[model samples]
Target: MKKTWKRLNLIAAACGILVMSAGQAQAMGLLQAYEAALINDPTYRAAVSENTAGKEFRNIGRSGLLPTLQYVYGSGKNRAEITQPATNFLGQPTGGFAVSNYDYTSITNSLSLRQVLFSLDATARYKQGIAQTNYSDAIFSARSKDLVIRLTTAYADVKFAEDQLDLYHAQRDALDEQRRINARMFEKGEGTKTDMLETQAKLDVAEAQVIEAQDNLLNARNAFSAIVGSEVTQLDGLRAEFTVMPAKQTSFEEWMTVATENNPEIAAAKYSLEAAELEISKAKAGHTPRLDLNAGYNRGLSDSITTRTQDQTIKSIGVQLVIPIYAGGYVNAISAQAVANRDKARADLDSTRNRIAIELRRQFNALQTSLTKISALQKSVNSSTLLVEATKQSVKGGVRINLDVLSSEQQLVAAKRDLAQAKYNYLISFLKLRVAAGTISIDDIQTVAAYFSPMS
Candidate 1:
């Protein structure tokens, strides 16, 4: 019984520690989400691994230009038999035959070195390696930027879902109150049956909407957790008076120029094209002569026929030249393929540029439209609030029915929701436009984060 109590105490302490750890994980913000995603996002991690492996291409290409050394050793036992018609010293064949048999062991050792004296293919490959490394770097940069956008968008989605759920709850509560009032009024024989039925129907619809909103919130939270690799019970909300500003560069042409120069996709495509060109050169180099410096030292023991012990050492150094005469059109075919690949790369680059241009314009226009819509919606929210009050006063004066007040309240809530959404869209479009212009950085995220306050 004492031992059981001790074990229970240990388990209780462990549970306390876990609770404390969970409590320490504060509500996540935009920048915090970005930081977590850097370590946790699978797509970004894959890019990091790929970039690390790609760095080896340089060393692989350089190996052809460096000297290589090798040591070789061999041991074997051999048996030989010889038969010959004997010849006399006077150069006349004797009428006799001789036969001999011998068994012997032999050992040999050698050290060899070779260095490329000249090779066009090796040079081209070295250049290609440099280009490939550049391409990898550009691709990693693109992925990093993509991660930032993805995290930010996901964070916004969670916020939007939460807001929608809150709005739905408020709407449901208002309808429930109205339904209760209608029920009491009908019991007193002061309200029509049709009016009570309509109120109950609206209440039921509101309840269904609340459930739908809850499910949406749950899904959004799940997506958020998937990116940050942790459950998020709460997140910071946008400040009440968050401001949206126009992009610094208003001219589309200027933004286009910047995108062309700085976009990682474009840079990667350019590097790929360079590598393809180098591949063509590498293939064409197949027809060129290759020169290599070779040197070796060798030692051998034993004579095969005499079974006599012998030792010899040989040392030699020379240059080897290989001129490719023919290869059944393989070289030409490969060269043609490389040229075609280069053309494809060029086309891809053009396509990427055009796509970026379209994206920039689209995001830019969306941002401009959001700014206008936000301004207009702000006024609409204010006007709707006044209308709700006026309708309530009219109901007190017996000039309007309860339904009119309820309709005004619904309009106010819808207007507020729309305004909130417009603000989020504006911020997102601002970030996306910068991304399209290749100017988005951590500063942008920080700026956006400044507009949010931690949940209380």
Candidate 2:
């Protein structure tokens, strides 16, 4: 009896250690994962690079409008030959001819500056550059939010996979225990061979389920690792008790209004439209005159055979005008193309707005439905748990059979799985709703992270 008690005490102590160790396990939360992804996610890194390049657009365009300076220098050895009919003192060409050859060095240096006094094309291009820069900002914003959505999705998938695997393991354990119980009863002649075989069949199915769940978990972990750039041994899991609130906006119209004003995709599309409209002006400028202020200083030495052994310098400044006359109808064709592009941009902007509206509606409805769905699933889990316990008692009391208990256990597992999925769905929907409204940010990530508790 003393040995038995000692064994029981040892078992209890071992279980306590396991529980403590599990509670102390290091875990990654959504915010932690996101921070890691910021430095590691290839897609986000590419977006950052693209944004950096996009910022140069403004500078590139402004350069065309600014004054440009150029300096040129040339030095070369020149050889010249002259053949002429000799002229006598009468200043008439004689029948005899004379040939001469000479070699000299020529040097030229020039500096020039040009500033656009009036150029519609350059002005329109500068405006378009500004608009394009703004568009890039909007695109980056959209991509930034998309990263959050993607990370959250991957994290949720890992969590769901973990939960599913855990439930499957538990189910297998329960079915195995039932199988053992039936085996003992059959050996004692208290249960039939039919009952034992049935329990074994169910246990086999449970084993297969556990195997599939493990595979799913591995796939989920791989996906999560792809975003976080490393394998995470543990992740903070959803809290058993958490609240899911309906969307703050009472109506879809309000969400649409907010999306129109704040959505990054819509903003990007609007900027693109603005740039396209400016493109028309730019194309039309091809047919207009351009005016510029030009200044130059030039120096030359022996630059020509007649000017050999002489040096010259000149400084000049003047206004230059260029008027377009004709160019094989290229200007008109390009102008028409620009008009077509502007129309396409306008249509694209409208399409973006409509798409945002549709997404907002879909997410808003899903969020509201998730709230109700989560509530119902919570109750179902509770009811299923109670039913499992009741069914087990019925089996022991002979009011039900082993099969009934097995069915109840399966039901309970299904209920728990569904509850977990609904919770994840709610979180994803909430985040997506804010994303569609263009209000999602790190704070939203933190808020969502709050729902994850350390593994226990």
Clash pairs, candidate 1, are none
- Model 2: lowest-lDDT 10 consecutive positions: 16-25
lDDT, candidate 2, at 83 = 95
Cα RMSD for predicted model 1 = 8.9
Q: Name the Cα RMSD for model 2.
A: 10.8
Clash totals in order: 0, 0
- The parts of candidate 1 lying over 4 Å away from their true place are 1-26, 75-106, 190-197, 301-308, 385-409
Please identify model 2 stretches exceeding 4 Å from their true place: 1-26, 87-94, 178-205, 245-248, 387-410
Residue-level lDDT of model 1, residues 189-265, one tens digit each, is 99988988897898899999999999999899888778776778789887878676655788889889889888888
Collision pairs in model 2: none
lDDT of each: 0.83, 0.84
Q: Top model by lDDT, which number?
A: 2
Over 36-77, each residue of candidate 2 has an lDDT whose tens digit, in order, gives: 666668898799899999988899889989999999999999
